[model samples]
Structures are given as structure tokens and as C-alpha cells.
Target: MTRRAAIEGKPVGSDAYVALEARYGHFTAMQVRDRRTRGLDLHLERLESANLELFGVALDRAAVLGSIRAVLGDDVRDASVRVYVVESGGRPLVMATAAPPFHLSGRPQSVKPVVYQRYLPHIKQAAGFPQAHLIRQVARDGFDEALLTTEDGVISEGAITNLGGFAGGRLIWPDAPMLRGITMGLLQRMDVPQERRPLKVAALPELDQVFLCNSRGVVPVSRVGDVELRQDGELMARVIGFYDAIAGDPLD
Candidate 1:
């Protein structure tokens, strides 16, 4: 496979492959390939908006799959997106949307991108079914994703996206299982201190709004854990407007 040395300031190809070693601590053949595939240039200018008050842009699956095809020279199909978007000081932030590991070492692998596995170790004391298994069950129950918080009471991210819950005049996050997303990262930088601790499912009623984020789905918080999330129409409109404005407009 053709490998790039680097992209903008981000790691790619072989460097990306190697970094997952340090991030995940051990090299499974499946993880190595997924890491490489996950590496792409995050061009915010191409996806940001006017006033620089950032909105989000959709991730083009075809484009990503095409790149993977170019690199691996193999049949690439069935890629799913995991969104992660953030806005900081009014600028849209884009970050990782990792695909599950694919075994290129000839094992006829079946991939299950389990969001629970990423944060399970951090919440071992929580009384619940295995997070990964629960996620699969949720999928079976007709939900698209799952959010796993730590024992400290902070909402983090989902099976495929980051969590944004509004309550008590602030946004909260548990700070485990996922990357501090580009959008969420920017929010934190702009004085939106994401509460990084353990969160509980029982706290849902207190949350006035809930939404998932990623660079692609730059949408607003609409629901949580089966409860109908409060809709901030103004917030949703602003986000949509921002997305529409930046998506096709010329950036300075």
C-alpha cells in the first residue's frame, strides 16, 4: 500500500500506523490497518463558515473509500462513519472518526465497531453489562449508537460520536472512551470547560438537551439514551446555517 509520511500537521500512513501502537499500547494486525485508514487531512477551511463561527461539513464516504482503495489497492466497501465535530471561539473543529480494525493479515475478519470497548477499562466498577455487548444490543434494539460514561458522572461520547449534553447552564462530558473531539476541544478552549468525570444514566432528566457530534454530522443535540432530547431550535438553526454557509462558500 502507498503510504504518506504526514499530512498538514497530522500523522498519516506509517506514522499513523505506529502512533496507534502507543495510543492502544499493543499492535493487533487489525488495529494497524484501521489506524492507517483513519489518517486523512483535516482541512477545516474547506468546511468552516462565515464569521468563522464554525458549523460542520458532511464526511464524504466515497472520498475516504477512494483514498483507501488507492492505498491498499483492494476492494473497499461498507465503510461506516463515526462523527466528531467541535466549535471553538466560533470556528468549526474536525477530528477523528475511527473505523473498526480490519484484519489485512488474511483472517476473514468480521468487524464490529464497538464503542464500549474503547472506554470499558475506565469504568470497570460500573454495574452494567459489558459496554460493547450492550452497544450491540442497542443496535439490535434499533438504535444507531451508544454513549458510555465513566463512574465519575461526566457524559463523554457514543459508540460512534461525541456527546454534547446541555444542563445547568453548561455542557458536560465524562472525558473517557474517545478523543476530545475537534468541536468539543475547541469548545473547551473557548472557556467551555467540559466536566471530565464519571456520568450516570440516571441523570438524563436533568439534561435539557442532548446531541451527538462529529465533523460530518455537525448537527445539534436531539436525544439521549431513549429519552426524547430537548430541541434547541435556535441552536439547531444556527448550526445548520453555519454548516450551509461554510460548506460551499469561499474561505478567506
Candidate 2:
């Protein structure tokens, strides 16, 4: 990911483009290139409250599909979107959604955020609808939180938090098939793991605690499936204290 000073330029593109967000000040723009799927390119921009004069552009459905037709001859019909909100302080924030997967035939399943990130342009298909679906599902499910596991069952990160486990009295995170969240990476760097692997769902019962994390920060799990997590006393206190220490200090 790269960050640069926002530049002043007029929107320049073909007829098959529509505006996504038009605000009044400073904003961050995401222009996706080298797209493998041939449709409208997914374009995103976020205007911070202080920078309200900026214009954030995203294509409307008609314009998006039209762009697809121009490139792939009108056969494409769907796309996905994933969102990440990282603090300037090196913390990573993630948000997943229920955007239905594409090139599937049956009643489509709600798309996960990771799937959206995998196919960046897909977000243009429904704009921000899937993100809304994901946020709503998180509130409804009362899930300790959800994490991304590879198709092979390696645990990575949660839609809103990173994944961690306490096994044999040691703090650990998966080594494969996951996102390697910023916090997870930090812990790993500190030599925190006792064992790391493609953690299996069958192993959940062997841990003392399970936790989730992200830039908005981490929340230790009290329960997982039929298993309940026990407080690790001092360890839990240290974790919370570390998070609280970094709460809003953007320069991390």
C-alpha cells in the first residue's frame, strides 16, 4: 500500500463511469489497475471529515456494466468488495461483507470481506451494499467475531479483529492460511508463539483463551462454539494495557 499527498486533478475517464462519493474536502483515493476480471474497474476514495471538499468517485451500475461491455463484450454480471481501514500508526483495520460470490449458479451465498479483497473490482458491482450486509451480520450473530481461514482451514483474522490462541499456556497465532493481521505480526515478532500451524476447528477446546484483533483493536474471546475461555489473569491485563496505550496515538 502506498500513501502520497492528495493531488488536484479533474476526473478523467470514459463514458462508463459514475461518481461514488462526493464530499467537500480532503479524501483518499483508491484506483485499481491490472484487473484480471474484465468489467468496470473498482474505484474508491474516502474523504476525512476535515477534508470535505474532495470528490470521491465510484461507478454506478449502468456505468460499471457499460465499462464491462467495452472490455469483455457484455457477459460479466457480478463483483465483490472488501474494505480495510488502517491507522496511520501501522495498525490494520478490516471489515468484511456478504457480497455474493460471482460465477456461481445456486442461490448465492453472502460474500465475505476477504473474498471481496481477492477480487477488487467486484466491489463496483453493488457499490457498498455488501459491506452493509457484513456489518449487520456481525451485530446480529453476536459472534465473538469472525476470522478468515483459508480454504484449507488455517485461521487468519476476524472481519473486525485478528485471531490469537492460548495453548499450553503460551500465546500463539496461526502460521498459515490467514491474513497475518498487524497485531498478529507484532506478537509473532515478539516471539509469542509456542506453536503455529493451520489451526483446526477441532483444536478449539485445547486452548485457555481465544482472542480477535484489528486496528479498532482487540477483544479477548469468552467463548467459542461450545467451548468457554478462561481468564489468563496477568496476561490479559498486559494485552489490554498495551492496546489502551496505543488507542489513538496515530503515529504508532
Candidate 3:
């Protein structure tokens, strides 16, 4: 919690820090609890695939994990961990950092729809200014978050979380192009009854429940613009129960 960070094996202010300002890179965020993480393999695969796509090279998973463990040390029990791979000097520089754990408010979020879509929606790249801008704009407008949509009014996802809904005893994910969240993928692997289909802003009121999910956790959406969503407690409990059952992979 002392604002510690490192690049490669050097501290942040060293000459190697130039990689942080690189124009192209991809990163993954995860919660490290007791030196272990959930969906650790999925996180590694995401980094490997993105590195290959951007740098034409496969990321070294062991090296990446080593960097993470090096920075985390043995003292930090719970922390927010981020691993970044930046293309610099025609090569990829992998850096990992760990900080104090992030805790969400746990209160239901109120979101407002915004007309926007991410470029290369599947990759979790560092170019997030547009999405960050939308989130700030909506926050100023008295909303907790922004629900991104395409020009045709089809919901793509939230500014930071994957959007999904409960309808007729199934989990309905927006079929539009967006980043495939690790948490979302885990839920699918757990065999949660789910379907992917295009969701429109105008149909918000028709859904039985609305929720947002990311690496942190799943949260209910109490309101989408002016439409109030029914917070089905039983459904949310089941979803959380599924997430809770997943075991974390050891960092060692």
C-alpha cells in the first residue's frame, strides 16, 4: 500500500520505465488472495494471445508469473494485481505490479446508456481513453457507470464490466462485440444456463434482472437510465454461489 511498482526487475522510475508510456500494450487485472488467483490459467492465456496478436510473439507464462510473484513478495495477502505487456523497441516488455486490494461498494449500480464501442473489442488493450471518458461523463450526470452501445442502439457492454441479464430462468449476455471477461468465461464454464443475444437499450424494462460482472465480482444493476430493474435476490444468490465455488490457483 506504499505505492510500490516495478518494471521488469527495476523500480518504476528507472530507465526501464519507458515501457509504461508505450503506445501499444495489453494488460490483465486480477485479485490475488493468499498468493493465489482465480482463473489464473485464463489470465495467462489472455496475455499470451494478446502478445502474439500484437507483437507476433507468444508471452512467456512462467516469466510473467515470476515477475508477478517477485513484486508481490510473501507479505501481501490480498492485492489488486496487473500484468502488462508493452511493445517497445520492436520487442515486448512484460511488467507486473501489485497494490492494495480494491473493494467495490457492493451497492447496486445505476447506469446510463452511451453511444460508443471499443476498437478491437476482444483485446484488453491499454487504449481506454474513450471508455474512461464515457465513464467520467456519466458519473457527472449522476450515474454510477455507462452502458456502452453501438450506433444502432444495441448494448455492447458496460464501460468496465460485461453486461448480462436474467430473463425467463436464463442468463442473457449481450451478443455484441466486446471483451470476453475472465469472470464471464468462468461462469460459462460452470455450466450456468446462459444465452448470448443482442440487447437493446429500449428493452431494458423487459428484462427480469440486470447485472454487471468483471474480475472483481458480480453486481446488480438497480437502474438503467430511468428504467428500474428488478433485483431478483434468488438469482443473484445463485450467480454469486457459482463464483464462490471456484478455487484459486497457487502462485507458488
Candidate 4:
């Protein structure tokens, strides 16, 4: 399907696109299924919080939702939606767009650990140069994605997803600094025993199972560097069940 996108309530080129090119911005990706999305409130909260921190302005929740609804119209149901709050001309401009859906690959994902960390690990910003560079380098070395870590060899998160794993019959997330993904938050709310502690890259082989969670979904990790991990079907089923049970909020 041809992807559809808009900026500031008009086509991409209708306005001075200089601001859109700016790296000083924050965005949130949502899986819009049937014009609804899970954790819609959380997404709005993220945008609001980032806007205040990055641009010293409050984001309008109603206006942002309105823009998303208007851009999606009444027909497009399932889409990959991204809302960008960029600083341009000393003002904050909100741009909402929808593209084709990107579902999770149920197959195991291979990742290589990289010694890197984000600048503002808390807020989800548009600073993609560092991570992108790392990802490109790792891809060329025969890895599906890059797992970011600290210089001390502590696993933090993936280039684009949050890292979690099953250890000793519990879900364990890294204790290091990283963006708290909405999907991870939802999974934690499911009453699962979760732990946030420093995880060493050398200890990955000892974990029962590992996965990557993001807006797309929970994806199993088969290999981290050269060490292979267990690909448990039971764990994948439970994760999928937890996410599938989440009720989506309507855009309208």
C-alpha cells in the first residue's frame, strides 16, 4: 500500500520544511489499529513531558489527537503513526503522520552488543545519529540489530527497543539508564515479577530467555553476539497474550 503522511495539517512540502529537518525534536510511535492505540494516554504524556523539557512549552493533547485523527481520516485503520514535536522559528510545531503497518517478526532476532549510550536516556528524542551509526556498523558485521551498553559492559537497551529477559522464572530488565518503553511499562503492569538490575553482557548466555519490546511488539532474541539464547515458545505466548489483552483507546 502507498503510505500516507502529513505535516502541520498539510502535505509534506506545503510549508517551510526547514524545521522538520531539525534534529531538536521528540516523537512517539504508535501502533494504530482500527483508529485506536494502546497506552494512548501514556503516549500523550510522553509528548507533553518531552515538549516541556525540550522546548519549554506545554503540548496540547487535544490538538495533537485532533491532528492524528484528521490525518488518518476515517478509513485508514491499521497504521504506523508518528507524532513529532519540533522546534521551528522559536515555536513548537506538531506533525502527525501515518504510514504502513510494521508487524513484529516472530522469528528470533540476532543482535550484537555495542558500547554506547544515549545523551538523554529518559526522554525519547530525535537524536538518531549516534544510534544509527552504531546500527549501520553492526549490520555490516552480520547482526540484525545493535544492543546498546555502557562502557563498563553493562547492557542498557537496544538501539530502538527496550531489553528484557526471563531469568529464574521472572522478568528482568537492565538497571542501567535507558528509555522506559511504553510496551515495557504495560508488561510490568501485568503482574509479572520484574527486576531492574545491572546486567552484564557476559552473563547473557545464562538467561533463560531474552526479548526486545517496542511499539511493534515483543520479539524474541535468539543470539546476542556469538552466544545463543533459548527461544521458548511458552514465554513468547505469554508475552503476546499480555499485549493482546490490552484495550486500545479510540482516537476520536
In angstroms, the error of model 1 at 38 is 15
Quote the positional error of residue 125 for candidate 1 in Å. Answer: 23
Query: Cα lDDT for residue 49, model 1?
Result: 24
**Whole-model lDDT, candidate 2?**
0.37
TM-score to native of every candidate shown = 0.43, 0.45, 0.93, 0.93
Worst 10 residues of 1 by lDDT: 22-31
- Candidate 3 clash pair list: none
Segments in model 1 whose C-alpha atoms lie over 4 Å from true places: 1-136, 150-154, 186-198, 239-252
Better of 1 and 4 by lDDT: 4
Report lDDT (Cα) of residue 102, candidate 2: 30
* TM-score for predicted model 4 compared with the true structure: 0.93
Where model 2 places Cα greater than 4 Å from the true spot, the runs are: 1-132, 150-154, 191-195, 245-252
Reference-based lDDT, each prediction? 0.39, 0.37, 0.82, 0.83
User: What is candidate 2's lDDT per residue for 28-84, written digit by digit as tens?
Assistant: 211122222211121222212111221223212343223323332223223232222
Candidate 1 has a TM-score of: 0.43
Ranking by TM-score: 3, 4, 2, 1
lDDT of 4 by residue, 60-174 (tens): 7766887688668778888998888877678888777777888876778899999888989878886577778888999999998899987778998999899888988899999
Each prediction's total of clashing residue pairs, residues at least 3 apart in sequence or on different chains, is 18, 16, 0, 0
